[model samples]
Target: MKISIFAGVLLISAALIFLGPDTADATSFDTRHVNMGMKADQCTAVMNEGIRRLNQANTFCKSTNTFLTGDNAYHTGTICRSGERGKVWPQNHNLRISLDIYPLVECNLKNKGAKYPDCDYTGVAYTNRTIIVSCTSDKGGGVPFHIEGNLVKYK
Candidate 1:
């Protein structure tokens, strides 16, 4: 009985040591949320959040914003990562953010292959632009937006 109990305790200790939480898979950061009002406010929120993420991930980053259309229909930007140091760890590649704030007069019920209605054009905008990161290779983030009436909500 004494031998059996000692063996069981050793086995449990070994399992606890081996099955510990993986540190590499636990360094993800959440992007900031911004839901004010108007198109400018929403766009600025996303842009600013992107910049903040880049800075948090690294010390050296080059971000450029460009307006693609009259309204906030589609805007594409890039954050180039270069020359790194310290605890800041970003993916060693250019981070490109392609934003498409739909229902901006271009998306409507009669707009060619329109599926959803005009006024009901609402969903998470930055669902695909997710940021997954660790202290190494796994690191990035995304922002999601929802439009209700004339106000925008950040997810």
Candidate 2:
């Protein structure tokens, strides 16, 4: 009986150590809710649309005579990644990765119009960039759940 209990405990411990924690919570970091094997053009369109929405949020705040903090801005745009959005890629992480999102968009809010308050109006320009993301397989295939980093230059 003692040996059986000890063996069960050891097995559980090993499983925890090797598998890490349950990744259900990680789904919150899925800013784009993208899946693995997505084509580059599709990813770019998604990213650009996200940026457009973010910019629209900023514009709305300005029009309403309100100023949103960085966090609020992200939230308003439905792009909130609670904790794992901008972390550097971990070498030992267990999640599958997809680098298919190449030449992505890097958006910035630029203030425009002299008499339209500080940031009431904004504009965006599309540019080619690279992004690194981590994915998790929950439904069936892998879905991207984190934006590991945005690469400026890559080989």
Candidate 3:
């Protein structure tokens, strides 16, 4: 009886170890994408703003992998593909700002589907400094480029 009880306990422990929640995994939750009706000129402004905020605050925030907490960040990049188009627009020097924000908004491989929502027309979120904006190509179906960042006063 004693040996059987010990074996049962060991089995249960092993099961929990293997099947319990794995916090180490990088995963994004509650992903949603919204259309912003933005243009290339606006996207440039957002990129510049994000970099400025980061530099001024000397800190950063990112879209957390947690579900529905509403803390948000933006990822910026240029999407150029042939055959199938998403959004098309002229490229300029400001587009390079995406590289600056890359570190702040990288998604975790485990949290693979993480995405931020579009900013309101006023471009304010939680505070005036944090904004979510997308630049859609004047051409139809060109994937929209995004820039999101925030400046907040911690109370």
Clash-forming residue pairs, model 1: 129-142, 130-141, 131-140, 131-141, 131-142, 132-140, 133-138, 133-139, 134-138
Q: What local lDDT score does residue 12 receive in model 3, on the 0 to 100 scale?
A: 99
Q: Which predicted model would earn the best TM-score?
A: 2
- Give the per-residue lDDT digits (tens) of candidate 3, residues 1-155: 99999999999999888643321211111122221333322432443344354463333323321111122322322322222321222363222121121112212222223222222111222222222223333332223244332233233
Q: Put the candidates in lDDT order, highest first.
A: 2, 3, 1
Q: Lowest-lDDT window of 10 residues in candidate 2?
A: 63-72
TM-scores, in order shown? 0.24, 0.29, 0.21
Candidate 1 lDDT tens digits, 92-131: 3223222223222111121233221211222223322322
Clashes of 1: 9
Instruction: Supply candidate 2's per-residue lDDT for 23.
Output: 41
Give the number of colliding residue pairs in candidate 2: 1
Better of 1 and 2 by TM-score: 2
Q: lDDT tens digits, residues 1-155, model 2? A: 99999999999999877655324434445344323333333433443355476564333222111111121222211112223332224572433333222323232234433222233223222223234445453322333455554444444
Q: Which TM-score value belongs to model 1?
A: 0.24
Cα-based lDDT at residue 92, candidate 2:
28
Candidate 2 clash pair list: 104-129
Q: lDDT scores for all predictions?
A: 0.29, 0.37, 0.30
RMSD in Å for candidate 1, one decimal? 17.0
Q: What lDDT does candidate 1 reach at residue 144? A: 17
